[model samples]
Target: MKEYFNNIYLALSTIFIGMSVTFKHLFVPAVTIQYPSVKPQLPTRERNRLYVNMDDCIGCLQCARACPVNCIEIETVKKIPDEDLGLTSNGKK
Candidate 1:
């Protein structure tokens, strides 16, 4: 008889706790945003794509070689010493 009452008490306590949590959240303000109607503001420097600075590149081909997917293709041409190829922004020939 004692075990039967304990089981009933445990079941009622569990239900009360669950209902209390549900009712608490029901009164709270909704955090969901209406997608097409309300657009999210992004930062000025947000980078959604990759950017490479060719001027600073040393043509080492290390990036291509290190790619696990082997998707990067790089080709290099040797510049003639007599021709003026010009200097980089950092003054490197």
Candidate 2:
């Protein structure tokens, strides 16, 4: 009796709520974009990959240490400084 009525009421409310959502979405503009054709614009300073200048890197690992998120990596071998050093990728001496 009472339990049956409560279940019926719950079912009716659920159906109405779902229909309302469907109706709302039917009139809304789509947010989808053609991912394959649309290219995202990135800033000049944004880097999607890792790059290093082996020659300019005195093996100080400063950049790695400065990363707040600890996302930077550094690897160095102890050199006598007398070894032949190459120029950085940026042509910085």
CA-lDDT, candidates in order = 0.80, 0.79
In the range 1-93, model 2's lDDT, one tens digit per residue, is 999999999999999999999999999996887766996778989866545666667877877876768897877777678886656778866
Model 2 accuracy (lDDT, Cα): 0.79
Q: What is candidate 2's CA lDDT for residue 60?
A: 78
> How do all models score by TM-score?
0.38, 0.34
**How much is 44 displaced in model 1, in angstroms?**
19
RMSD per candidate (Å) reads: 15.5, 15.0
Model 2 Cα shift for residue 76 (angstroms):
19
lDDT of 1 by residue, 58-93 (tens): 688877876767777778888787988667768887
Which ranges of candidate 1 are over 4 A from the true structure?
Answer: 36-93
Residue 12 of model 2 has an lDDT of 100
**Candidate 2 — which residues are off by over 4 angstroms?**
37-93
Q: Which ten residues in a row have the lowest lDDT in candidate 2?
A: 47-56
